[model samples]
Target chain A: MLSELDLSAIYLTLKLASLTTLTLLIISPPLAWWLARSKLFFRPFIESLVALPLVLPPTVLGFYLLLSFSPDSYFGAFWIQLTGSGLAFSFAGLLIASVIYSLPFVVQPLQSAFVNLDKNYLEVASTLGFSPIKTFYKVVFPMTLPSFIIAGALGFAHTIGEFGVVLMIGGNIPGETQVLSITLFDHVETLQYEQAHLLSISLLIFSMSLLILIYGVLQKRQKRLNDA
Target chain B: MPNNMLKFTLCKAGLFNFAAEINLAGVCGVFGDSGAGKTSLVRALIGLDEQFIGSVNFNNNVWQDDKHFVKTEHRQIGMVFQEPRLFPHLDALGNLTLAHNKRSLYTIETLAKLLDFENLLDKKTIALSGGQKQRIAIARAILTAPQLLIMDEPLSSLDAHSRALLLPFIKRLAKQIPILYITHSMQELFYLANNMLLINDGKIEAVGDPQKLFIDPRLSLVKHAHSGLLLNVTCLSWDETHAMLQGKVDGQAIYLAMDKPVEQEILQIKVESKDVIIATQQFPHSSLQNCFTSEVEQIEQISASHILLTLNLGKQKLLAKITAKSLQQLQLKVGQSVYSYIKAVSIIGEIT
Candidate 1:
């Protein structure tokens, strides 16, 4: 009865979600902090560019990444001469596209969180004898942890549901880039209704659970603040 | 105790350009209005803003000078802000230990008990009251074992009733570290300050004892009035035989037949200038019992109906408000000595 299960899609979806969440975690902090605290002339300009992914079509972004890394392109030619392999239609290329597609999901919440933080914390941190870097790590980072967690969870869930960008850049490489959403579409096109239903139910349940986790943690923090 | 000499200019308009030389051991209060540069003065002292000119030298170590600069962390100064700004992520114990420098004075449990943080250690900062948060912030600063402690209107955030509770902790803090408390309230200054710097226009207008100089309200009112000092009275015993009150004004004790009773341990009479009767020669059977021999310190007209007489009875200052017509008739001069008599009923307040 359970023979219609897509084991490969399940594995690929988990890998993509985990890798995308991990990479965004590393990339979002400094970018979010810069957007939150920087007073540079290029700050607003850079901020608008980071937010461009939010408004731009994911297919368009995926198409550009696919072209840029194709074997016939300059980036591909350069990579061929150096590493000797183009990233087009590869899992790595798909991951890069996924990062760009989910950029604002990971960053906007964190930037807002940093903005909401007490500015006096940093001032008092310096006065209390912590260096600038030490203050950021010891004070700013710890205070913004809840935001980071929520951002990571959202990015992970977003990447898990990704279909358009993965199809464009990944090209449905079985066991490699064919994530869950793409496989569910493939099952439907092939008249495999049972297979589609199984993958769809799993994706729905997984996304719901991740969202509930984020809400639960955020609510707990709010309750503690109210009680205090 | 060596005085910490610090000079700094504030290009910022609202703050002051204070050049204060003060002792660092006792509680040093920078008293002024909100925009009078109280916080700016403390911020400059602690090296939060090094852009200003001049230097700060504490115990021969210079924190800031024209050619060199030291950051706040390295300055060894502890700061407690008005809002407490407790680290919300950390519990009370963690908040207290955030700035511990691992010096000999490092005692987390001791401070927790002293600050009443025992029951609240496991509780999150969001669970604490406004006053409790401030206490934690103060404990965090103390844990650092800073050389100088700076408090910028720490009490200003609390309610009037809450301030009464915290005043004792601040008063007791004088025994531990030198505090620079910034405040605009005259009541806060009167009770809290031991040594004060009267900050006005971002400059040190006056620096001296809190009780001695706060005289006039507009300028020196704080210097004089806020002191609320003791006026030694003689012969406070009730006279049962004469069925009257007995007290002395200048030196000798006298009897009064006034109906009202002075119901407190101490009495302060606001010697209005009009009520006083000056006698050329010592009047022998006068109805006024409170008579004193005093020399005039200054004769200045305050209003059309009121002239202030600054009389000196020994070391005590006697301010009497009289009418302009009375001054013209008496021909009062600055140096002229005279015997002035006062009725016992004019005294306004009595304190136990």
Candidate 2:
């Protein structure tokens, strides 16, 4: 039911979400692991910082991201120096914003999973001659795989449904930056009711199918684990 | 030889303070009450506690000293936690092979056989019962073939039947490596410990043979109601005619109703002080199988209502806990001769 324009927006949205989720999967674990185990005085402060996006208005975060992505700002200048292009109004800028906005969704689940992990398993592994890094790879990571999957799926879904952050930083560049959420907004704004209905239905179906697939796989794994 | 021992002296900011220098030659039992620093000491020894100032020299290597801090993996130690601590994501076999050292003599199959849960190797740890998981935990630790094995109250969480099933395997493991066995239970010490260290209020109270440590009146273990004396015994012969298995304690003959033949000649027996009855005169036709005449060595008031009499039976000593009223009625006195009556079945555990 999607037109060629609508299809391009869907592809761009998937690309941004995929890139953001993959990057987050790599970046969030170490931060989440530290949050789970750190006893430093700044732990709570850092935790609140990571969780700020959960409570802050999307536009508020988008406004700050917009400022940072402006070529005049140091962060934006450094990116241009490295990549030979300004960051604002680009797909790259939207990717960065989506990552920061979806960070808590990726981190909190993994953090709690690590926190609830029984430390004795690591101790026993250590005494058995498994190095710390090896134990994490073989024991800790595998044990918490379900949580990691859930975190990744949540980050991906959150990034796909993101609008305000993408809108502010990306500035409605049709081929380069406009995503599915922005496209649907454009359709509704133009009173193209039929196109809006198709876009809305597709996004709804996509998000619901993703959640169902992830949660369904998790349930089967949990049942198998319980049975075994 | 001077540095071939586990020596550590640590002073912590709070929680626990301990210092001990002892050879890890056999089963060195760590005995203590709950929160008495037994766990803290073991954790320090294993390099799990970094908040302590200390030097731990193992086999002449500086594990933790003024200049070096070796990690637990490099220490060649295998640890069994009070809980199984198995990886929930792994099956029993996976756990056994998680850190399998190539130098290990005991295969996973062999350990599973010893633990008597061979059928469970393919099962996920989450599906196993506590006892079953603990059995796998023990087998998993053994498969690592560590230089020193530490077990912290491994049997405490297990049921009595599981404890019984596992006790023999523990005693068997003692022969394979220098073991550090930590337990608050006096009875468990008798099963595995060759030498014992008593910890109380963040200090080492005593260090000696388990039998000697148990009998030391100053130990916190003696104050407990379950306190008892452990003795080494040898099976002399089986009196098949009377369905009695004869054993000896300090060359003195004792009879027990042992239906199955004991595998080892040398065994350890725990005799609770309350189970021994004192009689002034010996009776030939008494119902009790053990009636040994012995001199009263010392007397201590255990509680307001109880008098603990230490009896010297030949070269060995036995404790008899009787009421102050019974002491008065029997007129028991130090250096006086009296018959000590121990029933044939009162010995709850016999470890070989």
Candidate 3:
């Protein structure tokens, strides 16, 4: 029911979203843990910086990212030297933008979970001869598994739905950086109403199903916790 | 210089200034009222609170000093907090398994059976009752094979029945390892503690035998209604016909009422000061069969109408609460001998 271009766009979108979610899951935990526990004077400043993407318009963030990715900028020049190519309009550039844009969605849930964790568990683990790493794996991880799930789901869903940032930096290159949202945009611009409707309905159905599955799992977990 | 001594000098500005250089054997009861920095002292001693300036040396190992500080896990100190502190995500068995090191003092099965919580092993921690949770906590602590065990008001939050059930387990553990027991209940101090450290206003008021500390006139323990002496008596014979046991304290014969015959040779009895009757001479043909001649060592006015008399009975000491009028009528004075008639003596527990 879909054209070849549409299929390719969907593939690219899935790859980007999966990679972004994985990257965020790897990096956000320690950052969120520090944000939740650190007493540094500048911790609030760092927290606000991480939360900036949540409130800022996607275009504003995309514009700055585009500037930083250009060949003339220091960051872009360094990246070009290391990767043997320019950053703008590339899949790498788009992934970097997506990860930055979706970071707060992953970090906020984890940070709140860490903050709400009962400190007595940590103390008990310490007194029981558990090292910090063992305690985190045995105690902290199991307790916050629900938060990790929510964070991963939100990050993946948010990256899948990204539009303006991908447009500003990725620039709709076929089979390279163009994703599902930009492909749908191109269809609507070319007066292809039938195709646009098909794509939109597919996206709507897929996103609704994803959200329903996530919330259903979360509700079951919450009921189990309450019953416990 | 002893290998088992625990020495500490802890000072926290605006909170407490505590210092103790004593060797605590068996159960050392840290006794104090509320807000007397008992919990603070424990937190400092165990390396939980690092804001204090102190030196804590346990079992010849330096736990904390000016330049070096050992983390709680490396200090080999097992702790049982007031709350169970069990991990809700883990079942009771899982929680116990987390503390199972190579140096564990007992196997998980042994600890579970000893603590009487084998049925609770598979249950979720949150689903367990308060007493069940505390039993699991105690088991987990012991499985760590710690050199010293510290219980910070572990039974204060339990019901009386739970406290009764757990006290014997704690007493049993004290025989194996030295314990720092923090409690506000003087009854528990007399029942379980051989050494007592009296804490008041964040300072060590006294540290010695709990029986002697109970009768220290300068301390507030003498003012408590349940203030009494814990006397160690050796059982000689059982009078099954009268449901009484004949025991000896410092070679003086004494009688105690018991519901059943006690098989233990050494029995500790709690004699409340209110239950002791002082007389100038031995009264004959009375219901009281436990009587002894003791010399008056000290007397302190407890209130306008009541006075506490410390009587020296051979090597043992006993406290008797009497009215000031009775003291004057009997003309009781230090160095004068009097007959101490124990109205009641409750068997605390068997001391191993």
Q: Which candidate is the best by TM-score?
A: 3
Query: Candidate 2 chain A, which ten residues in sequence have the lowest lDDT sum?
Result: A124-133
**TM-score per model (chain B):** 0.67, 0.82, 0.84
Where in model 2 is the C-alpha error above 4 Å?
A: B1-4, B13-15, B66-68, B159-161, B217-228, B250-252, B257-345, B350-352
Question: Whose DockQ is higher: candidate 1's or candidate 3's?
Answer: 3
Clashing pairs counted in every model: 22, 0, 0
Model 3: which residue pairs collide? none
**Structural similarity to truth (TM-score) of each candidate:** 0.76, 0.85, 0.91
Q: What is the full ranking by TM-score, best candidate first?
A: 3, 2, 1
Worst 10 residues of 3 chain B by lDDT: B220-229
lDDT of 1 by residue, B1-352 (tens): 5445444443444444667677755576778766777777777778766556677777677777777788888888888887888887788777766777787264878767666667887778877888778877887888888777788888777654445545656667766777777877655565567778888777878876664445443464433443233233443866666667777655655555545565444343444444566654788786676777888876666667776676677654556667788788888887888887775344333211
lDDT of 3 by residue, A1-228 (tens): 789999999999999999999999999999999999999999999999999999999999999999999989999999999999998999999999999999999999999999999998889988997888898889888999989999999999999999999989999898899999999999999999899999889989998999899899989988987787
lDDT of 3 by residue, B1-352 (tens): 4467888899998778998876778899999889998999999998899999989998788999999899998888899999999998888998888888778768999887777788889998889989889988988899899888999988877765567667767777888888999999766776678897888999988899876777777787765633677787888888889888888998899988887887666677878899999999878989888888899998988789998898999877888999999999999999999999999888775332
lDDT of each: 0.73, 0.83, 0.88
lDDT ranking, high to low:
3, 2, 1
Residue-level lDDT of model 2, residues B1-352, one tens digit each, is 4334877787677756677778767688998889888888888988999887878887888888888899988988888888888888888888888757789978887877777888988888777899999988887787788888899999888866677778767777777688899998766776677788889898887778765556567777666533557666777887767777789887887887776666666666767787898899877886788877788988888789998888887766788889999999999888999988885335454333
DockQ for every model comes to 0.64, 0.64, 0.76
> Cα RMSDs of all predictions?
6.1, 4.4, 3.1
Which candidate, 2 or 3, has the higher DockQ? 3
